[model samples]
Target chain A: MSIVVTYNKLVEFGDCDPARIVWFPNYFKWIDAASRNYFTQRGVPPWHATEREFGILGTPVVDTHAQFTNTASYGDVLSIHTRITQWRKTSFVMHYEVMRDHCSIMTCIETRVFAKHVGNTPDSSHHQIKAIPVPEFIKQLCGFSQ
Target chain B: MSIVVTYNKLVEFGDCDPARIVWFPNYFKWIDAASRNYFTQRGVPPWHATEREFGILGTPVVDTHAQFTNTASYGDVLSIHTRITQWRKTSFVMHYEVMRDHCSIMTCIETRVFAKHVGNTPDSSHHQIKAIPVPEFIKQLCGFSQ
Candidate 1:
């Protein structure tokens, strides 16, 4: 079984649109935060720290699919459940489910890559971002053994 | 031919993450705005106006899929090209392509519905949002014939 992390959020007035429902894009924002929180809760170093210790800058999403099941408004307390579903050589898949209390509000699946900085120098501003193999330490930190 | 609308945006510093690259969620934000801009440019009335005239609050996305091919940074001006690819009974599909000059940055496809307010009263805050059939006038305005 994979480890799951739940990230809680409080929907604010600004998170809604004139129609009085949470703007769809705000769901993506919360999902992204949940994605980061998943790593942090798994004892993985922050992106900046990882950049120094390892060559990884961060996990950048390459593709995403989302489905909105229910509408939520301001004052809604939502919880996002995140877990890594698959780990490939250079990419991984993350799944998220947003719940308003017990009701499922939305769901998302993202394909992300561990981005490495490649250039003439480490500090160069013109560095290229490339996908790197899933680090062994990261997989173990996330409680994956296979 | 379908009507295509191009929405231009200037990437601000705040749009980037600590990695100095455009945050993935920001692309969804811009794409949402571009979705509205597409309707506005195609002669569809704004949501507020339609709420009174046609009982439509807005088009809400039910599903979305996005692919990021390249990274973008601050100061990079992006142009989102949006168009309706299909019009169904109660839902429609919108396609968007984000481009920096001649380079393609990302692409997204969204399935959205024209949401109607349904309740005991039109002005009730507790009204339910339901999908409505695509209006004929809206189709004509968007240059769709079938």
Candidate 2:
């Protein structure tokens, strides 16, 4: 288990749909931000720094499951609690719970991989990214005792 | 088997992140649109029309699972293919595939319910949304034989 990190977000007007409720996709956006906050709160450097130091470009989500428990709308203050529940060689599971005033709003789990750009085809402008092992130094930085 | 309907979208600049790639959550937004398109393509009315006719609000997402296969950036033209894979008493499952030309980008399945508003408390401004039985007329409109 990793340290719990919380990210607070204010639901904006644009985040709502014609139904006047927070669109389900916006929950995933907050979950993604909360995911990064977990690392930042643990003193892990930003992706650019990690890329320069360890060649790890960023963590890319491979699989995600989200459950919507309640509806929300703009002007609502939501708190996202995030943590890494499991760590593997190349992937980790991030769990997020979005709450509004002690009410459960949504919950999500994402499986993400630390990735690096691969293939240097001269003709292709975009390079494919491949998953890489979780860097040990970064793991220690996350305070994961192994 | 359900008839497939495709929804086209142009990836906008705002849809991308600092990495210049389309943020993953945007894919869900497109999936939601594609889900609605599946109904429209089958001659089903919009939610507002349905609400007026049947007191049904809209399909509310309860669960979703997504897998990201490839990365896409701004200015990319993408197609989302969606269809209802199964129908239950009060819920249905939608399957979506996001394709950028010939490449597979991401795929998702969502479980959603036909919902309606319930309860109007004098003190509480918010009302709870509850799932209702899948309307037979709506199912027929979606081209479901049974």
Strongest candidate by TM-score: 1
CAPRI rating of model 2: medium
List model 2 lDDT by residue over A66-86, tens digit each.
999999878789999998888
Q: Compared with the true structure, what per-residue lDDT tens digits does model 1 show for residues B1-146?
A: 67789999999889988777898899989998999999898888889999999999999999999999988888889999999999999999999999999999999999999998667475544335889998889888889986
Tell me the lDDT of model 1 at A94. Answer: 100
Can you write out model 2's per-residue Cα lDDT over B1-146, one digit (the tens) per residue? 78788999999889987665788888888888888888888877899988788767789899999999998877789999888888899899988999999998999999999988776688765646889999887788777894
Clashing pairs in 2: none
TM-score of each: 0.94, 0.94
- Give the residue spans of candidate 2 off by over 4 A: none
Residue B100, candidate 1: alpha-carbon lDDT: 90
TM-score of 1: 0.94
